[model samples]
Target: MRAELFDPRTEAVPAEWDKFLRDEGAPAAWDAGALAAVAWTSLRTVLLGVVADGGQAVALFCGDFGSPRRRNPVYSPVGGPGRPGVYFSRILMGFDEGFLFATHLDHAGRVAARRAFERALKARLGRRCLGVVYQNVSAAALPVMRTAARLCRPVSPNTVLVNRWQSMEEYFAGLPRDRRRRLRRTYADVDADSGLRVGAGVPAVDPVEAARLEQLTRLKHLSPGEVLVPLPSLYFERLNHRDGVRYFVHTDPATGALLSFDLSFEHAAGLVTTVTGSAAGAATGRGLYWDLYLREIEYAIERGVPRLEFGKGLVELKARFGCVTVPQYAVAAPL
Candidate 1:
């Protein structure tokens, strides 16, 4: 097997890269265009492609090389704080869920591909490279990952709500009595506020306001001393026009003020909620946050989406809202 690296920002990724993802039933996050969107804005992003005999593309891995200017949780805390000239490569850059596979390969073949990719990564990033980190790895892929890296630990669980009910009313009826009562109260409060309305689909959002709200929500959840690179307003503006991405927005009707927004990626497999934020000084305790989850659930149910992935964080809280926690792991190997 041979491994080759391509900078999606400058090089045109081979068509086979995305074909392999589709044939293997990969998620929307693995889409070449989506990855390129992120890569264009990131400091350094690379795609690792593995090919077997006869030049058959066996695997494609995407990630970003850590930069001191932008410290991301995926790579920073895993190998210590970010420092100038100290770098690590983190696979699965754009999304925080799912695992990779060397498609159409057996155990031994898969292991070899993993090893080749690692070798290429080390060669690409020399002595300054601290390690290669794989984040949000699922259980089934752990064994293969362990073959190349000894460091592995459980991170946050990815929350998913498997839709079973036929409709929103059916879903509400099925919830526990206490939860049902609280949900009803929340709905009533939201309904009474004629000024606030929840709508789906991408709207012409003000990039500046949207970025501001997203940063506020992001900072509120980060652990102390942890640093994250903030996505610029331009990124949001570009995503607004991208297909397969939509926003569930809460806005004040009369004033046309954006209150809160939840962004989700629509895929054949399911709906994955991505970034979420609320305007600063927005009224709290009115169930606005909870409404986002409920609206996402309703949207999924309406579309017959099998699952609604809420991503990581707030494990217990998400569980109470009928989401199941899927354990996620991170593996780090020093170069």
Candidate 2:
């Protein structure tokens, strides 16, 4: 198989390409539609392509926006996943921005896929820079990456998710009764506070006020502190998109101070919870952690997203919400 490049808007990348990746357990972030949506931004690029025998389905090495040539500690930017064999120019920074399919080749294909990735990458943007992500990685892609002859920065800061469930309810029922009871209690405990009332959805948005964003930002780290990290203002501005992604916010009624914010994407498998933040809402006993994560479960039910995937592997707390593990993989090589 080999990799190729074409505009999704103008060219046909092949349905089989998608079918192959999806069949391999690729997540929502990997959808061609998602790739095109990302292309809506100015920085998107089309590098190279990876194709198998008879031009069947294969993976993509997609990317977008280059980091500033001059680095800023504040901007911890990464690349995007896109059409196979796509490449972003050196006009960007340290990030080797583009889609190189050889990344995260299925484990069975990793050894060969790694060779394909290196060849594909060499064809487009000759080895330069560093920093990239193997979106929705799988074990297949790992082997090639482990042996890639490139300057790759290993970043596993986020966790992977897996779903080994017949039913979401059954998954929940699987949790220890005491843990389930505690989760239930936390939901009630937070609501009991008189001065602050808790609610969900987009009905309440006060992003202009740093306190609200701050609450969520902190909860992202599961931390409670005045310790604030500056975030891309665009994150909040883009939050108002209202067209593609669905957001569920937990807010304080009286003061309108945001307690938490969760963002989920409607993927083929289910509604994948990509990013979540919390102020712990009201300083209740269990704090921002839900007693039973009932709200998350309720939100998933409301959306009818059958399998709810909490980002992979912060198991201790997220597992209580009945999220099973889903692991992703990545691969890379030098020019």
Candidate 3:
């Protein structure tokens, strides 16, 4: 088996690309159409391809070799071990690294396919790129990366809430006593704050306002001395209307000022909170972050979805909301 590369933007996108992803139980973000739509806006060198055997495509992979500075750390021109940049495969929507081989492949086949894909990728751009970095890799994909990538390490751990409860109270009851009290107190405080108004769906914000919102979100999330890759205001506009996505915006009731926004993606099973941002000032009262988290749970219970995905970090707070933690990792190799 060998890896064959194709450009989804330039070549005829195969019908099987979507079908393969679906069959593998891939998330909505991994859908070829969605990735193709937004992939180009940030990445310059994109690699979309499949693992083929006897001319039949059996597995698929898509990635890019570029420094998405805003979303990632700064890098040097020649990237590698101790180098600046990286060859990355970022899964869109979900904001994870993108890497999916056919789940049906037996152990040996899976290993071979990974090796071939890496070999082919290296031949194409490995010489000039830093190294391959596959972010947020799932446990099932770990074995294949054993031989394909060199260093493997866990990054932030993910936390999720399986939406099996019938009511918001039932959901809250699952948390420990301390957590339950904390959430109730926080929720009550936010509810009593007259200046705050939290609502689901996109708020009425013009392009300039949207840009400011994105900037605020980036600044709030940035670490010390980190450079943020600026997401275009248009990206937010497009995401606000994307199918299966729900936007929860927090505002000041009196002045209609945008306080915070939560963007989550919906699927057959449940919803995953993808993007979030808030003004630093909102940190003081009404607990904008907790408010958004509570709103998500309330929304989930009302809708009766089976799960709510809260990506990595805020373990203690998310745990208080009854979100179970799931580990997330990155697999990389020195080119």
Instruction: Tell me how many clashing residue pairs each candidate has.
Output: 0, 42, 8
Better of 1 and 3 by TM-score: 1
Pairs that collide, model 1: none
Summing lDDT over every window of 10 consecutive residues in candidate 2, give the lowest-scoring window. 89-98
What local lDDT does model 2 show for residue 9?
41
TM-score of each: 0.81, 0.54, 0.76
Tell me how candidate 2 scores on lDDT. Answer: 0.47
At residue 58, candidate 3 shows an lDDT of 71
Arrange candidates by TM-score, descending.
1, 3, 2
lDDT of 1 at 139: 82
Per-residue lDDT over 53-110 for candidate 1, one digit per residue giving the tens place of the 0 to 100 score? 4577776666667554444433322133443233333333334632356556887777
**Best of the candidates, TM-score:** 1
- Give me the displacement of residue 40 in model 1, in angstroms: 6.4
What 10-residue stretch in candidate 3 is worst by lDDT?
Answer: 75-84
Rank candidates by lDDT, best first. 1, 3, 2
Candidate 2, residues 1-335: lDDT per residue as tens digits?
Answer: 66554544446766665666655654434455544433443333433244564565545555442332222212222233322332332111111223334334456564555456556555444333333444444453455455545434443333323444454465456669987676656666666856455444442245444234544555555434323434333344444443335555655677766566655555455655554555543333336545224655665565555555565445766656655554543444324
TM-score of candidate 1 against the unseen true structure: 0.81
Which candidate tops lDDT?
1
